[model samples]
Target: MSSSSPSLARAPHHDGSVTYLGPVPTRPGGSVRLRVHVPAPGASRVRVRWGQDGEPRLRDLTPTPAFDGQWWTGELPLVNARTSYRFLIEGPDGARHRWLTAEGVSEREVSDRSDFVLDASDAAPDWVADQVAYQIFPDRFARSAAAADRELPDWAVPQAWDEPVVAAGGPVARQLYGGDLDGIAEHLDHLVDLGVTTLYLTPVFEGRSNHRYDAVSFDRVDPVLGGDDAYRRLIDAAHARGLRVLGDLTTNHTGSGHEWFRAAAADPTGVEAGFYLFDDQGYHCWLGHPSLPTLDYRGRELRERMYGRADSVVARWVDAGLDGWRIDVANMTGRQGGVDLTREVARGVREAMTRVNADTWLLAEHFFDASADLVGDGWHGVMDYAGASMPLWWWLAAPGARPHATVPLPIDPLPARDVVATMREVHARYPWAAVTASTVHLDSHDTARFRTLAGGGEHGGVDDGSSDSGLARARHLLGAGLQLTLPGVPALFAGDELGLTATTGEHARTPIPWDARETWDAATLDAYRELVALRREHPALRRGGLRWLSAGVDHLTFVREHPAGRVLVHAVRPRPDGAAPRDGEVRLPAAVLGGDAADAVTLRGEGLVRLDDGDEPVLALPGSVGAHLWLLPGDDLAWT
Candidate 1:
């Protein structure tokens, strides 16, 4: 079986086709084997190139007699923090059609012109772990009623809030809700009060719609949302308030109206042809969506212009004091069987970011299994949607939904044991130091609002609809408490803290009703504040290993063990009906319930409570509809 045979089973490819080749415990100046799978036969020549910027280095592979169809491996000498490179399958007559490039090039194009390989030593910046991110949808956040309402820009038409979010043809909802960067700057104090350390803005680059995901120009900020100066001012204002801001970067595709796309569409072989996937019939769009045309990263000039070179769009933004970038659709970057473009892009981004700010964070928006993509020294971390968050939602909100639930009616809450076990497995698989920076949230712009999922009200309905406010608040508190106390970072969507319930998509993205603060349910906010304060006060809750104490269908309790000198016992209950009071003593692990050796414990009616013993404290088990976070003191003890 030659390497080109498609039937041959190949080893699973790493995150983005890049491989880690070195001693298990890597040391500086060591040597390792770099292996890649090429499924082609009759390959006479294989060429490899390795070097850093402004340097030429080379190597060639001799064919192994009767080579198996499996992976074809190569050896390379390792040097600390050096940008090395390699390419296999050189001649056009060879059967092999695939090879890995340090520059994320397509198989057809492999030359010295490609960008430099990423240095594996680069990791995600430090600030990412300690930061709290707040996502802002520009249009829906806040409107400056005082400022003149600008006319609808090109490719955008104004419509009422109730209108559908269709494309250019339909009655599109494009009303200028007036929320701009200046408005965001004006409300920095409010963000500070909410304890946000980072502001993750939706794409502010030049675009037509409210959501700027369909970018027209990566270099320019949208004039409707404020221009480059406005962005800089916003960044400055946020910095003044001790906040960091990261702009969204959409690299997978661009708007059809983008200059590059327009040029490519006009002439198939134009200068911009390499920038897009153009054929006789215009440029290739994503999923046939005319508005978004995919970019062809195979072109050396395109990669260098967009991601390479000091003056590249990515580098330019970082140089402008932008904290970092949130890469959109990261998993979709690489071409099939070619170098993982995302890894290459991430490398360029990392280099550029480190050059600008060593503490800059690189957050990728990947909505799939990200363990491989996030690890392997490619990115700091992706938006963690799998490990901690999805499970919680499945257990709490859509329990009756498939895979987890077995019966109809109200499904049983996710077992506390299962939650802890899943958390443990995820932690074991992805250590906190390596892949812990995650944006844990109930909902974002992509999904239905948390309140609506919690059965607060019907979609497209008025506020008169009733909600399980008290029950929902309790659940929200429990979720928020766990989120804050968990190992990874936590993110709270705007208006979620104030218990803003939305029945429709537009409602979910509506501006924060500051006036409603006095009238809206503040229980969620209060609980979040308390949890945040608790997390801040206790080192254990901030950074600690979690241990499950007791868990059942109705009640769940766990403890956070900190290395410093603190422990926190947290508990939550779902049953609305109170637990029957047990007259006999309830024995608990001394680490959890830190009181005199009581053989039996008494339970009151339905409510949550926390008991402090010496410095250590225990959160008493809540009977129904409540959550408790108790601060504990003294050395951590093992719990069974």
Candidate 2:
């Protein structure tokens, strides 16, 4: 008497209509109701059935004179959890369809997948709030000295760090720096020193190329980057150092070399035929990319194999002590209007992870306009690019250079305000429960380096360029400050602390030059380190409600306050000649200030001030630089 195997019962019907009901609950004799929605209204008879797996029972449900074309409800006796049932819809001319017994089951169609159900009790771990994530692109980070000792595999070629990656095309320009997990493990101390509490490794699953986005196997780690044992040891070491590890999970597509794709491509009618969408026009590729083939969740066996059944591939990884999953291309999972396959996958992943660790998080990578599908009941969080990085570029680079306007591009300062407004609006529309905890980042392996985007080497300023490195660093710091102070979890790309600039693709994913003191801008690094320390010290900066105080042509100010007595004020000055008054002031509703006429504040600007008597303490800005202020009641010299 399992839940999946339920008893079936049939009932008498007239006007060519019949309704079949469940294998009643086996626990007890509680009352249950059967509800149905009829689209077309007509003179019809309804039949209801209920029973256990072995024994079947039948009953007739007569249509009342006041019957409408909408919903119909009936009460019946319930048993226990060991019951499964379905409804048989009978239309005119012997047309029939079967419907499963579930709360949110779809009547129009029946699929092998189920929707995700979320509970507040199933919230992600509390420690996740304090985590500072650093994403690593394994192939470009660092090369392992141990790789030379190991036997070379057939699928991969041993390339030196200086060698360019070889593909079918002549001499691929993007160089392979040979960065691996062992390399990352060797440099854990560097990350720890930079205040990183979580490390998100790009797909380490066995694959052919440097970027492992096109996964070939979900069960084994890539041998070239040190296989399963290497990953296990890396996770162990990371955990020992108080760092959480999240592995990237690619579900939307697989490599052309994957077993399922190969099998399906060889034979159209094979067992793996439904695993991917394939026809004469090559395999069904995403965005016309032949190397990566999209997965099809329509097949019952495929769904069960990939995401439906417990102890599946996804569950097995969670059981292996992996902290969480970062889903790739989440928006394309269930595009066809059947049952949302993405939700189903999320549910299965969550259920399996919950079995191992209830607080496990599920983060999705959705490119654009995925708020509706991702927020309500789909994923725990998403890779937040729109709310952070996009706004940052718009604010920093869009002001001076119109990269998208003319032939050479003209910088438009008008869009800068719109970008900030949009970010604030998006955050407001999708509050903390939906959007706040999202991972906010500036640059990753996919995009150009932040410095390069800010105008690289055109004029002489910072790093022999007219881009003004100091101003760029200030804007970058301002962006980081905004991200850390906002509701979402702030993520920093490696080497961003030292103001690393990129000239090309390889430069964007290059290793952190820890030994290159000459390349590092000490002042910029200090600013970032101070910001990180400030965020770590203040609980309000990590998880708080953001209230926009004011926004102008050259100045932006905001306040972040938590439920506790912590409050932080952030103000940015974008123009050198613009002397905008810092009119916005944060005042607590409750009087935390005593009768002491003097007030002491720690401001980010030069010099210290002690106010004797005033309604509000004012700090003057030094030139065009930005400032952060912390107000305390009494005289305390301890500055964070």
Candidate 3:
């Protein structure tokens, strides 16, 4: 895994990119062609070791002449629902060989758990790879003039658009900024301008709080957020602007005030009573919170009402023009104590949504490790906080300001190598389709702002003046570049690009300040625009396989390879001690780049200069906070 040697960089790379592996989502009993790059001074013989009929089998792979002798390939039958395989690179001496698996190259045998996977059930919608998503907290995004006429519920404490957010103490959830669906519809132009293809609203169902995770009803939109009619209009307007909208649903529980909970609490013999778990003690609430009642999937009636039937909540929303659903607290949706119905609930949701919209996306919000539930039979993708966000946070966190509350133990700053290692380890656990479909974010509503982690001060609260510092802006933009260029859908929480800051998740919900353009971070916004445009402009960034080129304490480099192109990215982080930055150099292997240094061309970057040393191209890294990208020629790199 060391980047000091070019041989390590060329150590037999393979991934599920269409350019490398295919017949994607192979059917049971079908054969799939698998390929791997074997650097020059080729292996004596290359073979694929796969699990077949509960036994390990090896099949020889010959040099793929179409790839100019640098690539080796063969076929393997996917006889099981989930087939696991790895490459065996045999050296000239029969006694020496290397195992190539998802965990990277190894001289000794590794566990099968690290093997590359192909699942018959894992197929994401083709459109997923091309999306850039924006997350919106509805209450703080924007509000239309119509919101003024609507009556506020008893739980509401209304605030002006320009009023300061109350992050703590009194009525955090009750303080409504009056942002409604019609208001969101009116702001479609801003999304289009931002170059996002999808908009993800946190929960929109009628709830008792401004942050509508506690839903009082699932059948209708909150009347205060302009009702069901406004919801439809927003979806229509979004679709017209070529933007897809995803709704958030809390399948694990509902507000204690929800009609089903209300009905069940009133009558033990009622059909709705079976929908919840009750004992002599009382009904179960999510995380023991009295205001949020948990749903029991053991009851068939609850399943039918939630997602089993055509009239179910899952079906109704997808049918109502939601392009997809972002299941809230998805990691805990179906299990309580010894009972576990997580997969069942996921399958039910997927099936119900598919019945109404075949292309609808089913994404889960799992704050930690979610590999056990990402078998592809259920959610197409997850929020991927564990795989992408957390690692990035550790690498880029400000000194003494690691604010993620989920981690039970304290975490110190991580080196760039550890960051890439964590990402690879987590990403390897799922099928390639799921990996590509997942969302990569820096921060969300559940954690501290990424800006705060990148040295924007203690918190991103509106009153937190650190949000506007030059160093914070530079580091924040660097993190954004990394997010967009990675091999997944890049999602931006609302107001992040505007340089909005908060000390915690609740405080991060600062209004967009639409009327106050002067308050916006114009530089950060412009950087976001440039980064997203770059991602959309290149196929490699959007739909490619990643290969790490180098990793150091302050510099991380990688390449994204696709049939259409190849992009090499080098991200540099500033030193925390404010010392002069060192020059980090990454060498590009000719075997991997498909040619000599003459073929590589610089795209756009800061403080970077390319130096060619014969067959290998060396990238002179920038000491300051910035990201550089280069386009390597792909004409000779194409595979059949």
lDDT of 2 by residue, 160-266 (tens): 65343332244332344556678789989877777778888889887656677777888788877888888888899999999898888878888888877788878
In lDDT terms, which candidate is top? 3
Q: Which ten residues in a row have the lowest lDDT in candidate 2?
A: 1-10
How much is 459 displaced in model 3, in angstroms? 6.4
User: Mind giving the per-residue lDDT tens digits that candidate 1 earns over 57-95?
Assistant: 567644442212223356555454444465655443744
- Candidate 3 lDDT by residue in tens digits, 1-640: 2134453566788898877887654368888887888776667888999998899999998775533245787888889888889999987566479998886888997888888988888476778899999999999899999999999999999898877776577888888899988988998888899999999999989999988889999999999889889999999999999999999999999998999999998898999998888989998888898899899999998999999999999999899899999999999988999999998899899999988988888899988878788874798889988888888888776766655677544447778888988988887788888888899998888777777766675544332224346667767888898999998899999988887877678877878888877767777888899989999999999988888877878778888988777888888877766664443454444455664445667776854355666555554545556788878766666765
Off by over 4 Å in 2: 1-121, 150-174, 336-340, 398-411, 414-417, 456-468, 503-507, 514-517, 576-600, 606-623, 631-640
From the highest lDDT down, the ranking of the candidates is: 3, 1, 2
Lowest lDDT sum, 10 consecutive residues, model 1, at 1-10
RMSD of each: 15.1, 16.9, 2.4
Of candidates 3 and 2, the better by lDDT: 3
